[model samples]
Target: MDKGKNKWAVLVGCNYPNTKYTLHGCINDVQAMRDLLVKKFGFDPKNINLLTDKPGSFILPTGANIMKALNRIVDQAQSGDVLYFHYSGHGTLIDKPFLPFSKEEAIVPIDFNLITNVDFRHLVNKLPKGVTFTVLSDSCHSGGLIDKEKEQIGPSNNHLHGDSSISCSKPKAIPYESVLTHLSSLSNINTTDIGTHLLEVFGADASLRFRLPHVELEFYKALKQDEGILLSGCQADETSADVISEKGEAFGAFSNAVQQVFKENSGPLTNAEVVSIARKILANQQFEQHPCLYCSDENAAATFLPQSATAASSST
Candidate 1:
């Protein structure tokens, strides 16, 4: 868990599953991401791992398969090693409150069933201290993942759904801290950050019993300085994404935006650049999908590798 030491990563993207839950760009985009990490970021193939549901001559893994793969890496995760978690697929909210959950947990995965807020708390709590974690979620929502029901936009500026035209002016950037402030005002019990607050909106426990639940999370605080970052495609008030890109590939604008950034940047780029690039791509994107990024580290950055070069390296 030394920040000055070397780093490692685990990549997961699911697409073309035998089941209907499969998505369009999860697999392809992750593959692209892995490539960028390797050839560009200089990650050792032996050190970097890839997980997906697709079964071919690649490092792809399935849902259950990915769980097993997680078993192999989580224990070895030391501090300072960057752990980047990415998911590109359908995301919905489970309205059933019967599923028990705890405060320190949340289930943010691709295919989740019988997954409770407590379930999430258990998984993240195991991360090694100081091991930087970056989670990117590009799916339908309520955390609040799903909208529960479809929303019809009205033409009025005040209407937000469909024809309910929202503010005609360009959506301005709201400070991340401000959103956190708004989120904080909503809950009075165990005060927490944006991630914790969002999870609590529909947090597993409804009674709000214990002020602090004893979940075994590495506690983002323990590794707050290990370069941890989170880039959400949308805000707590908005849906993530669902769209196809210019390549005719069905993908969330976020995932496509990620892939596009990897393609253009030949060298190391700051997180700000990545966010800016993704935002620009979304603006011109065929659909209304607008990708976004969130960060805790002001100086964190990523380098990308081209597709052909990455594939060739993986093949060897």
Candidate 2:
């Protein structure tokens, strides 16, 4: 099938407001991306869908908001449509018995909620084959949030534990202390609340003290790889930064770099090209950011993954 000259780009960037424990720059990034997609990527404004924190939390995605829109937008997906999904905010991973959650398993909001990886999988499953599923996550513990963290102690569990990495085989368990430590640092995140939940899932093990861990993203399943991509600002081994410049203005290092790359580069870039340039811009901040690129285009649609993620490989 031939591609649509007017591809769709869905961007979600949030900027937390009225509080310190919120993400304040993602909202700007989402809007900026929306503009770039329209002006540079040939995306029609109508095809672009943007979501943010509800009731003016101003910057965050609640589980309800994500679920509500999942079906509506997915149903509209057509062959050759490019579904661009970008999330900039908080993220986490679960360790132990972590099967990806069904839609009901997680709640998402400024109030602190759960969102399992299956929610995302379900969204992908609903799309017509050959549509581009691009996602960018800026949250610290985001990897596990996309995958289901299972409780290790099962069948009359005493403590709670779950892991969120999904692969062809059953997912391996991630450690509890690792995921929780990331949660504790969030401005409004309560260590007790995160710990309590982990305890419920894994069962309290006095022998097992909690340790902090970074989130990790599993590669896409081959069956689901009709043509999708994921670009992370950095690897799980590194810390994703909140940019506080000498001017005292704060933003996500990842998001800021994205804006810079587009602002500096001319014309539409390929997926590899975009990732390459974004990598450079991010490195300048000393954040050790790395732009990731994943493509599921059997027809080689990855070559057409918006010239954003595949920047270096293409010529503008």
Candidate 3:
């Protein structure tokens, strides 16, 4: 860790309780991550901000609130500082006819407000040099959450065969039509345009990528950056699993695999190494979802959470 530099993090988990989209393990995932950061990684408790949808949570994991927390962390970042954002929730894909891929990745906030990959690209472009912003998203279709980042590990045509024995698993994703229907009910706007529904509900707080013209969206996506690192739960076309263990504990499969990797390794591991190990763990456990790492080659080889000087020193 750089001496006197700070480490900041924003952890968000949305269970969407009491609704049709309820998830059982997202909150538990973030809580466990928070404990790991504080106990194992030497992150200060105060510097780690948490947003969840559980009853009486100080801050709800709404779209605007999530962005505010992220922006706050980035605004306070300085050279050599390490920043992290972890989100365990539902992810969705939006049709973007303007792009060659014909779709974009997004995370679903509690209020049906979706934050798109283009929005992440804009946020990442503002980072100060020497400040690393690493994001871990344990949600479905999260592979490309940070747009235009170099693909160190990505989708493949060959699917790894797994046991498929896990019986109580659910996909942590909401379809685009479902999101539009939910938003339409709230905004009283009946249309297929999700952008219109989001604009009506969130106004200026809505993601600009949704409302921007196709040309502007392309421009934002074209902006380049080296500061953003993403560890996704699954490939762009795959779904991450939320499993109910035999012990009745609920957690995201990818999140569980990550925790297992950390437990199995004592010394610091590189970003790519962590993802690679987690992918193998999931595959061995009969999961089809493949975790991915998105970053420059240099960052791929960089030590995971290297800014935690105390943890690094103590582990050695």
Candidate 4:
């Protein structure tokens, strides 16, 4: 652990207000996580960058804005610093026709500009070797959020096809009504069978070939060697629950479970331990989705928030 290293966090939550996909808990989830980071993990409040869909918020979680924020995080990060990204929103899977039977998982921003697993892979690959990137995604189809990372704690991969790390059935989808609402809000977008058009135009192998022209083919070919820890809300085929808790507060089931688990445990927990306990908590609450952990085998046993948890536990 780097004693003088800084801690930076980018917390994003999209509720998609006024649309058919309006969620009640995304913003709240990020807020709760922000608080936890500051209070428990020793993250400096000023270093935390928050992007949310609440009206008049400083920044909105649009795809471009998100990319910019991520770039800033990576650019300013020093080796040994801890970078954390938390996103609570809708997730989807888009087919990559270039690769036969390949579907990329994506996080939906407020403006509907999709941020795919490829983008995340690019970001993670750019991180300094010693820096740790932790991503917590509380969204549907959130498994494999970091792209090509090994699943340290998840379902058996024997059922997964091809290079997919998570064992999942057919990917679930957002409601068509939500898709219509989003498309209709865009200027000059013809809403007539726009979904079909998206599949035909964006789904083709041609566009993907040009998507990242700056990067060499080898960049996409190689799996990332940097440390990236992903805690996903559910398997690729499952829908995450966004329900109100018994106390009348709304939150994503997996996010809430993680919070509760973290609050209860004071010892230094590994990634595998945290995921295991969080999964049990969600299951006890009757959530259908199962939380997953993805990282290298060594990191699976590393202390969660390595510096913070270790220091705290040693002090006790």
Top lDDT prediction, candidate number: 3
Q: TM per model?
A: 0.56, 0.64, 0.93, 0.82
Model 4, position 74: C-alpha lDDT score: 83
What pairs collide in candidate 4?
Answer: none
Give candidate 1 misplaced runs (Cα > 4 Å): 1-4, 16-22, 55-68, 96-111, 114-129, 142-227, 240-247, 292-316
Assess each prediction's global lDDT (C-alpha) against the native.
0.46, 0.50, 0.85, 0.72
Q: Tens digit of lDDT per residue, candidate 4, span 157-244?
A: 3322222122222222465346545555553466454344444444432122235543453475435455788999887667787766
Which segments of model 4 are wrong by more than 4 Å?
1-4, 156-210, 213-218, 307-316
The residue-by-residue lDDT of candidate 3 on 1-316, one tens digit each, is 3332778889999999999998999999999999878866778999999999989988799899999999998888889888989999999988774555577789999987898887788778778888888899999978788887888887766455565445588899999889878889989977777788889999988997877887777677635548789999999778998888777889999998989898888777889999999988898778888899999888898877763667656654
By lDDT: ranked, best first: 3, 4, 2, 1
Over the stretch 52-94, how does candidate 1's per-residue lDDT look in tens digits?
6666636544334444454455567775555555665544333
Candidate 3: where are CA atoms >4 Å away? 1-4, 97-101, 157-167, 222-225, 313-316
Model 4 local distance difference test score:
0.72
Q: How far is candidate 4 from the true structure (C-alpha RMSD, Å)?
A: 6.8
RMSD of each: 11.9, 12.6, 2.2, 6.8
Q: Which candidate number has the best TM-score?
A: 3
Off by over 4 Å in 2: 18-20, 54-60, 98-108, 142-224, 297-316
Report the poorest 10 consecutive residues by lDDT, candidate 4. Answer: 161-170
Which run of 10 residues does model 1 get worst, by summed lDDT?
Answer: 146-155
